[model samples]
Target: MRADADLDLLGVLVTRRGRLMEVATVLRRYGFASIAAQLDSAGGPGHRLVQRVTDRFIDPELASASAGERLRGALTELGTTAIKLGQLLSLRPDIVGPNVASALAELRAGVPADPPGHAEDTVRAELGADVTELFREFDPTPLASGSVAQVHRAVLHDGTPVVVKILHEGVRRRVLDDLQLLSALAVWSEAVSPIAHQLRFAAVAADFDRSMRGAVDLREELANLQRFGAMFAEDPGVRIPVAYPERSSAGVLTMEEMTGHVVDDGESVRAAGWAPDELATRTASIYLTMVFRHGIYHTDPHPGNFLLNPGVITILDFGDVARISSSKREQLEDLIAAVGGGEPRSVTDALLAITDAPPGIREDEVVDDVEAQITDHLTGGVDAIDLAAVTRGVAVVVHRHGLSLPAEIALVLRVVTLLQGLAADIGADIDLRSITRPFALDLARRRLDPKVRLGRAVRTGRAWERLAETLPGELSALLDHIRREGGADLRLRDPDGIADHLVDGLLTAALVLSAGELVSRSVPPKLGSLSVPGLAVAGAAWLRYRSIRARRAGAPSAAARLRLAERVIRSARRPGTS
Candidate 1:
């Protein structure tokens, strides 16, 4: 009953009517009256009364701006949460289209620091102690201010230099309110707008919710710092900020002050004792190692986030990190390898395999698109590489095919694009293919090692063993239930084909496992980086697996995409609303 009521409350835009009026006003001012109309209608009768009063105040000239210009202006004027959304959208050309994404990319986060004494009071409240008790000297002035938080420099009682981050007063409640509006709007759009449905705005709204909540909490940032500290503990070239967990709380973060220059002004960085080219190289190396070697990395790699010292580099901001699984990493390797190899067919195949391409997508069109991209940006030697162009090309190509890269994958591309831009800004020459190809090769060879193959085979075998052990019991339970129901008519869909596929899968698995077993024992017949007999067995298994995939290719399963029930949801329930 409570769950049903929660759903009931969530479905009504009138619950958040005041905020909706605010949002609708901004939407209309920026030539997005159509979107405002949707929100107004979603709010039932009350909004129309409010809408007329608000509409008289809006000027018509704002609608004369270009779509991208209007959107950028609207999001900027909407303040913190909206600007953050625009930044997020900047990474997704597939959703907002290239023009808007480009404009959104220019959106900057700059807010006036909160009133003085906020950091002290927040620290006192969160830490359960006065600021003087924790730190000998706390600067009232902020080092910098962002949409969500502002940084204040301080000195610990023990005289350790540090920076204190304080969440803006009422920022959490404000972000939640904004996200609620966005999520409700997304839900409404999915139901009424075909374009929004295809773009999965509801899912995007959910992402914004997660991101905003995470950003609002300082603990998540503290934990990320610790993780990165451990990750780069041994590296002399890079430094992760040391966070003070004992003094930190969800609303306040205190970490070791990293004293260096943000790489924006090339002269200052050179003055700090590192040349621009060297700094860029080190930054690129650090990011590449984090992505290729660790499979997890910081998402924001702009010049602002990197701090340069004489011989050391400090990375700032930990709230937004993206992790790719090992399988995803391998898929990325395949895609990168295809790009580096200049094989359009291979690139198309890898992209299609990794991305969520819709059913009935024309493969040849995808290939042609990819081929054009490679020919334009990658055909020239390493010096001619334009990762930014290549990145946009991939986004355009995928969007054209009605496909979307997984959010994490799109972020990875965003990172690559940023790094390339970083390199260019600092006048550094970077050949991405050269930097990444060696790592991909090493990873591939490592995967083929006997120890790796044997470990995987063992895990697979154990999984099968568990399934085999439980199958009979599960079957008995099902049969018993059917018997209690007075027997059942079991219908099968092409049972012979199913059985054939199952048998082929098992046989191929066995052959691969056998090959791993032989290789583990140091089989005499050897090929370069592999055992000859094991290689042959694995080869046969690979062929069989390929054949099975080919046979099943035409009859692809079409997973349900439409979410009518989900879209039917109304506006979010506000804080004081029933």
Candidate 2:
């Protein structure tokens, strides 16, 4: 259901039949006619009409394509928003299968460079000056073009080499429109389709929309670059490009340009005098530190995003990043520790702590699968293990058990996968366990620190104090209700007529209450060898014992009854002469 204002907006779009028809035609061509038909049938606030057109004319080439391929092709054809969504989906192997994720990974935005003067115009508009005013030299030709922005080589007046990233004109408006359409479709699909509901289409769409919108704003990326630079300020091996905020704006970013050997090029890296294995290890260590210590990390780990210049590793592209919460980070630490220690139960518990598993999923099965995967991968030693494969294997098990990884964890897993791929490409043999073990151990030790334990105890004390303050009042209210009603309401399911035992329980409760009252009032001793309270307690215990004995004795023994019946039958046979 939409509000009046939303309805008006939808009406405006409906008036533009050309755009709607274009979207429908594209969907139909991409083997998604069923979805298009659903949208088309849901027209203008009335009852939805049945789609009578059974003949769907799909593209012949797409007829034999796998579902992943068709989806990849459809997203590629749908433009920037769809491309960004595909890229995000590529990181979510738990939501989508590995096959779909792999196929989506191959999806390239391939946005052609805007016309020559477009970049200059954007720069002028964003910085309030022509390129000549801001830089000593500006190249009009773009170095690269992405879905959101394009970069150009330039130099500041101080003669420092830099890159100017400029957002495309009208891209924000276009992306917003597409996002609105997608959201609307998602809502409708979730309402009508079981698969969409299961996949949580609306939630994923909202997250994707937010991510894409964030990516479109150059200011966000600039902030990320600055934060990452600060994080690695003391580390000499890792280099984050310097962001020039004075020369940047919401739609424009200026950063130091990096020129070096791409990390994926093994020959080039070796020629540059860097050992591939050592470089890989260092790279893993840096990322691991970011995740375990800082809790903020770059999500993308493709080789193009890394540059090996001289002795430093320069990271690029801050457009996509993820932040992990402290609790999630702790869970990840536990998971790492458990995996390293080869504790399957602990690993399962840690994973369950971080992810949401479906009801009725067998924890033992998931643990067994994970343990098997770990054993298979680590049997040859940690150095020979593939971190990405291990992570993927865990992801596969999670998916099989109908569990969903949190978005942050999914992105982390994606980064690990990319790093592993990069390592393999460079023929680098690095032990991920060795890199993570120290951090895990340190975290475990920190958890057991006296200060941490004291803090936890203080928090627990406060929680208990609160409960204590409320418990007395709650108990008083319950007693008041029982008194007013003359008895407590109780429900019981008793077979074998054992509910008769409740009479003895009632007597015991009465005796206990009486004894408590007598003890509180300091009643005089009345029994021969005990005080009044002690005698009452003794009588209650004796009554309980007698009740138990009576119940057991009253129940007949099958063998004794059978023998008595046989004796009666034998006596009757002896008198058969009569």
Stretches of model 2 off by over 4 angstroms after superposition: 1-21, 33-55, 187-198, 368-376, 458-578
Model 2, 19: alpha-carbon shift in Å?
5.2
Clash count per candidate: 3, 0
CA lDDT, every prediction? 0.73, 0.72
RMSD to native, candidate 2: 12.7
lDDT tens digits by residue: candidate 2, 21-105: 7767776676664433432322333322322242256677777876567778888887888889889888876767676788888
What are the C-alpha RMSDs, in order, of all predicted structures? 13.0, 12.7
lDDT of candidate 1 over 232-344, digit per residue (tens): 99988789999999999999999999878778756777877988767766677788788878988999988888787779889999988878887788788788777777788
Q: Estimate each model's TM-score.
A: 0.74, 0.76
Clashing pairs in 2: none
Give the CA lDDT, 0 to 100, for residue 387 in model 1.
77
